[model samples]
Target: MRRLRPEPLTPEAFAPFGTVIEADPASAIGINAGFTTRFHALAEVEVEGGAPILSIFRGRPRPLVIDMLERHPSGTQAFVPLGGRPWLAVCAQAPGAPLRAFLARGDQGAQYARGAWHFPLLTLAAQDFLVVDRAAPERNVELADLAEPAQVALDG
Candidate 1:
């Protein structure tokens, strides 16, 4: 098995795949009588053939071995942690492309670009995530088997 170490997630490192959703002071706006700071437009929701829908995904801890990856060809997918638990986002530019893993903090979220290959959610602990994606009758997921399994190394 191939071993892959996840790097800490940042906007610059993750820009190739998609946007990193988090509260940015540069994009902050004081609203609601200056009591609430709204981090507006952190990520864009792109849909090709369907409307976007909101859903909650409860993820459980799993082994860090990656055997396959999936992608949404018709829309972007966003995962925002509701439980404030760190998680992993594994992605590649295309099928058979070199893979990259990111270790995202609890306060951070990820929005995978349309047609971007990514492994399913890898939660460090049991947690809930607010998901935004397309809702359509047609199947939107495409799966590809990796040439070899990659084991994610969490320890430095």
Candidate 2:
């Protein structure tokens, strides 16, 4: 098993896997008497005829040990944090390749592209997230057991 450190989450770095949703004050469009800002189209929701389902995911803080990963072949999936807390995002180009981690803040969200291998939801606190994903009739998830697990470390 190998240890890996998490990089800061950014739209450019995470572009390969998916989109990073963050409300940037400068980029957001102002509206509502100059009191509201909007970061439009933060992530692309590609369902491809699959029903979009919304669910809530509650997660607790724990050690980051990458033992397995999964992917949705039918459609893309997204996770938007409901609470203000930092969480870890682990992903890889492929199942056998090295895993990369990102530190997502409370305000940030992520949408994984179809067939993107990623770890389950991870967080430091008991935080809830709003998830929008496709509902497929047949099982659309593929899980892979990693031969070697990696311990994810935090980057300063």
Candidate 3:
């Protein structure tokens, strides 16, 4: 098997899945810093369900990686990144069609496109993050056990 050196996370590359999870400060107001706002509503994007749409995705800081992988016994696999800066990575699928990544300076939170592949979560200097993405729920669902516990990473 080949190992992918972590690249910058982008929605273009992770399009096979879903939208990259991003947190707009303007949308963040009363969120508890020490608390988690559980996701009760099935947070989802209905538009990009057919084609791929990869781009920047961000979210809040949590100690764990989100459920962003589906066992699509068929089709391609997608991956995103999770960190406080601009970063891109091909976490799951084979890198090709030429993949690219980048991160904004001083950003924050952990992100995972519904089924986007990504390195668990990273806080190089602080609890900030960005997530790469992709998804195909119809093909598979996350199980109590890691369906594919792959080790994801990055450098620089």
Candidate 4:
């Protein structure tokens, strides 16, 4: 099995796949009578033929083994953790390409670009995530099995 060590998730490092959703002070705007700091437009939501829908995903901790990856060809998928718990985001440029794993902070979120290959949510604990994605009747998911499973190392 292949071994992968996840790097810290940053906007620059994760740019190729999609945008990283986080509260960046550089992009902050004060609103609501200057009481709330709004981090607006952190990510762009894309949809080809479906409407965007909001859903909550309750993810549970699982083994750090990756055997396959999936993608949404019709729209972008975003995951924002409701519980403050660190998680992993596994992505690749394409099928059969080398995978990139990111250690996302509890306050951070990820928006996978359309057609980008990524593993399903890898939560460190049982947590709830607010998901933004497309809702349509047509099939949108495409799965590809890796030639060899990859084992993820949690330690830095």
Clashes of each: 0, 0, 36, 0
Question: In candidate 2, which residue pairs get closer than 3 Å at backbone N, Cα or C atoms, i.e. clash?
Answer: none
lDDT (10s digit) by residue, model 3, range 18-50: 344445443454446747553332224322344
**What TM-score does candidate 3 get on C-alpha atoms?**
0.32
Q: What is the TM-score of each candidate against the true structure?
A: 0.98, 0.91, 0.32, 0.97
Tens digits of per-residue lDDT, candidate 4, 15-134, equal: 999989999998899999999999988988999988999999999999999999999999999999999899999999987899999999999999999999999999999999999999
**Candidate 2 local lDDT, 36-146, one digit each (tens):** 877766777787657889999888887789999999988888998999898888999988798999999888999999999999888968899999899877787899999
What overall lDDT goes with each candidate model?
Answer: 0.95, 0.87, 0.36, 0.95
Off by over 4 Å in 3: 1-3, 21-90, 93-105, 108-111, 128-156
**Stretches of candidate 2 above 4 Å error?**
25-27
RMSD of each: 0.7, 1.7, 11.1, 0.8
Model 2 RMSD vs true structure: 1.7
Off by over 4 Å in 4: none
